[model samples]
Target: MAERLPAGRLVAAQFAACAANHVLPAGIGASAVNLRFLTRCGLSTARSATALAVKAAAGGLVRLGLAGVLLLAWPQTPRLSTTIPRNSLAIPVVGCIAVAALAVALSRPLRHRVGRVARRVLTDVRAAHGRRSRVCALWGGCLGFALLHAAVLIAVVRALDVTVPAGHVLLAYLLASGAAVLLPTPGGLGSLDAALVLTLTAAGAPGSAALSAVIGYRLLTGWLPLLPGLLVLALLARRSVL
Candidate 1:
């Protein structure tokens, strides 16, 4: 399926659809069955959002950490500087240059190390804990998701016939996304919307145009992804795929 589609998108979409079906809030009753194997193996069976949330946090921290290093080395980074903005968030991403040539050793060591840590943690919890642990390949997932989001944004901006540099677009996304993390609202509702307006406007995008772009992007990333997921949950609940 992924081979039939461009850029492995179908595979991502398929996992997303399946997860949405199984992980809906109403599917709480069904989740136990789908996750029974993990439970039998004595692993975490809590919310899928738990792993995704951790991934988001890990993504922010890793990107911020990388940005800090770059900013220190070149304090007065020009708005046009292409180095960090293009790849800052990607530093921790799996299969990237940083993960390969740089942290090759850590990547291999983490599996064994994480397995040991997971066992120790589980040992302490025993039967008392109701929720299971949810550890994912967070760095890679976030990078992939972010890339998908960025691709949409770039496509929109270019579709609008704008000549804005890619650096400006990426910088706006990173900064706005950083602000989105600060707010407590689910998925940075109001804050992210505002940040998009402000960042794009600062980059000379007209308020109305930028607002439209942001709204469109949100529909794709937020509502579009979520609604189908919700439906999947509903259908799975009715069919018992939880």
Candidate 2:
């Protein structure tokens, strides 16, 4: 799809989309902007939106599964605190169920209002699925990206002069990232930083080192890219590509 546009323009659009996540609440704005950009890149609106949703869902599942495996394999890992927050996990699950139930109850009314939109999305996903190669590529990219993300964190650990094993760093990163998703902050922001510091510290790194590593990781991955991304975004927008 990107081959349809100038390479620089495509890159710019992507950078803009990513930057949107940081400033927007919970990434809703970023997701919407990315979907629109995808459509502008030649995908149908429904296909673009569905593809994003599918990729996100796949990535989430992969992270959760990886986190579970890490926890199970290292069952003796130190507990960060003696007492867990009351209903911490249960609250989100219950809230999701309540929201789902409410949606179901309002389904008739919703259908009347947005039936066309829903049907269009379903049709697009079905059509996209028929292209097996594309679906496979999408999932492959998602999984690959997840691994690379963890690897970056592992590098951050090393850069901090932390002697923790690479495997431990990877596991801590995976678990922390998975936990961060439960927080409602955009791009996980403060929540992700806290999770990473705590998880790394719990994994045996010195507390100061863990905190420093988290800060450095975020600087490299998040802050450093912001200006260039915004510049690219503006360049692309001026050319009418986004």
Please, what are the lDDT tens digits per residue for candidate 1 over residues 1-242?
A: 00011334323334344444334332332233334322333345542333333444567775565445544554454542332244533443544654545554667786666567556545433422333321223455656655567678767877777666555665567667765544435455677778777777666677787888788777777676776656654554464333
lDDT, candidate 2, equals: 0.73
Off by over 4 Å in 2: 1-10, 42-46, 78-90, 111-123
Choose the strongest candidate by TM-score: 2
User: Lowest lDDT 10-mer window, candidate 2?
Assistant: 80-89
True-vs-predicted CA distance for residue 22, candidate 1, Å: 16
Model 1 segments more than 4 A misplaced: 1-42, 45-54, 65-136
Clashes of each: 7, 0
Instruction: Please give, for residues 100-121, the per-residue lDDT of candidate 2 as tens digits.
Output: 6688677897656466766776
